[model samples]
Target: MRGWGGTGCPGFANLDKAEPLKRGVQCPLANETRVFRISDPETGATCRYAAVPSSHTFSSAQQVCTSCFGGQLASIHNYHTNAEMQFWGGIEIKDTEFWIGGVIDYQNQAVNCHWADGSSWNYAHWQQGYPQHSGHACATFCVTDGLWRSASCAQQMPFVCEF
Candidate 1:
């Protein structure tokens, strides 16, 4: 099942009727720290987006973020942050999906989705009926609906970096 983000678009209105799909894993990096100066002209904030290769899994992508970009996977907090990510990711990746900082808690057998940065996963924009309990232990931000979706951690996809 897919998740929903906006309501004006097709298939976006029926998200409430959709079923929760498999959830992903969100393990924080140890001693991971870095900084960048990718300034957003609109918000006047410094943030950056790094696109991992399509052959990198969500776990490996996190390493890329910590080692190469000096940051972690993008941690979206609100609609504006999500929109900004969607905008820049669309321009950078064009037609590819990317990983974000969301993971599920399999130990508890629940959808305890949390960000890699240790932020609370209070805000969400699932495609429609997603976060299934399938065996997919990773999360990816889909370009089609601009919403978060579940995937196998081993599945390779480009990823975004946040500073």
Candidate 2:
């Protein structure tokens, strides 16, 4: 099934979700790393996102992100981050569908989904009865309903970018 990021606007961001380590900083002990926060640190996303209005095939969209924006498609793992992606598309391309960094794969006749950025697949907000799961398909975000939907890989549409 497709995963939701704001309004179905397809966008991508850099991959590298793991927090980078400082050159000389010692690894923190498990207890030392345990800290409380008002919200998940990933809520705001470490990268920035942009909603491109121009339509493109999925591959083209990805090219644009990597070549022009220096990032790949976005990876959404939380509701808050998904909502943020939606905001960019909704505000800049209201009610438009965009690409996100999601691609469904098949393994042992079962369907699996992942973000192009290679982050953990922990959440999804699919439109009812969606993802069709019949062929090679990609994930898309919709601004009109703010839900995730599946689409053919070659379909031309707007997308989001994170860099």
Candidates' C-alpha lDDT: 0.61, 0.63
After superposition, the stretches of candidate 2 with alpha carbons farther than 4 Å from their true spots are: 1-45
Scanning candidate 2 in windows of ten residues, the lowest lDDT window is: 29-38
- Residues 1-163, candidate 2: write the lDDT tens digits: 2222332322221122222233321222222111111123654325556566667788777776665445566667788767766665677654378898889876677788988877788999889977766657889998877789889979988777665
Model 1: residues >4 Å from true position, as ranges? 1-45, 107-109
Instruction: Give a tens-digit lDDT track for model 1, residues 99-160.
Output: 89898655545566788867678688987767765544677887766888887788887777
| TM-score of each candidate structure, all chains considered together | 0.67, 0.69
